[model samples]
Target: MDYSALRRRMVESQLRTNKITDDAVLDAMGEVPRELFVPRALKSIAYLDEDLQIAPGRYLMEPMVLGRLLHLAEVKASDQAMVIGCGNGYSAAVLARIANSVVAVESDAALAQKAQELLVDLGASNVNLARAPLTAGYPAKAPYDVILFDGAVQQIPDSIVGQLAVGGRLVAVLQADGPGRAILATRTEAGLSQRVVFDCSVPSLPGFAKAPSFVF
Candidate 1:
């Protein structure tokens, strides 16, 4: 299969047509071999305009949504980044091209192992795969310049937000209510400042459900 040609088509059709504009983002997405991240049976459809399931409850995020969120995050070359729920490590590979270094955290043992292998094979030297609970952001390397969620979440836990360096940006699909919305949250001097960047549809990362509310 002509994966390279298919990737180009994806960039022009799925991405550019959908309003993904950042050059760094465009280049990384265009360069990454997405087909390598999915099961071989699904490789032909890996670049389809939807999230490909890697596990029962987790998915490799849809390309357009991922692209848009990263574009909103404005990842810089010198920044340290973290990818939460980094299924198959595709997001980390793309971030590795842009960010100086990336620490990708995954909770599922099988997925984490597969991601680590693929990353190593790709020579993603700056990307480190760590197996840990997704909700508890890797604090050992806290104060990251950028943090990205590879899936949707009902809310950003204070603990995870605390990992971002002041002035750092974290982006994710926040589906707290109604339809999902892409959010760009910046760790600020005062506190975390977040705003809706756009609307999106992304499967939830395991363990990010909002806390239950009490009623009278």
Candidate 2:
């Protein structure tokens, strides 16, 4: 499969057409070889503009949604960023291109190892891949300027919010009743406030499922 051509089409048709106009995001998505981020068996469908199931219950986010979230996060070249559920580390690689340093957290040990190898092979020196439970955001590198959750979550944990610096941004797909909402929550002097940026569905991150409440 010609991944280059497919990637070009993805940027042109999916990203650009869908209003992901950030040049940094467009260039990074174009430059990163998506095929390198997926297992060999699924590399042929790497740039298909849809989520590709990676493991039994996990998936990579679609390109357009990922691009839009990255753009909304407003990653700066000098900012430190944290990426939750790094899934093969593709999103982290893309963030590394824009952020000064990136700490990518992965829950699965095998996927973490794979991501480390792939990032090394891709020469993404700015990204550091670590194995951790997906719900527990990396706190060793606390006070990150931006936190990006690579997939959807039923709710954002306060623990994760505590790791961000005041005024830092957290971007993720927040699952609501009707549909998944792409939200950008910013840490403020008073408290964190979130606004829905767009609507899209992405696979949910493990351990973020809302707990059931007791009956009245």
Best candidate (score: TM-score): 1
Candidate 1 lDDT by residue in tens digits, 1-216: 999998999999999998899999999999999999988889999889899988788888989998998888899999999999998799999999999999999999999999999999989999988899999989998889999999989988889988999999999888877999998988878988889878888788889898799989
Question: lDDT values of the candidates?
Answer: 0.91, 0.90
- lDDT (Cα, tens digit) per residue for candidate 2, span 1-216: 777888889999999998888898999999899888777888888988789887877788999999999989888888999999998888998898888999999989878888899899989998989788878798889999999998999988888999999989999998857799999999999999989989999888888988887999
For each candidate, how many residue pairs have backbone atoms clashing (under 3 Å)? 0, 0
For candidate 1, the TM-score is 0.97
Clashes of 2: 0
Error at 171, model 1, angstroms: 0.2
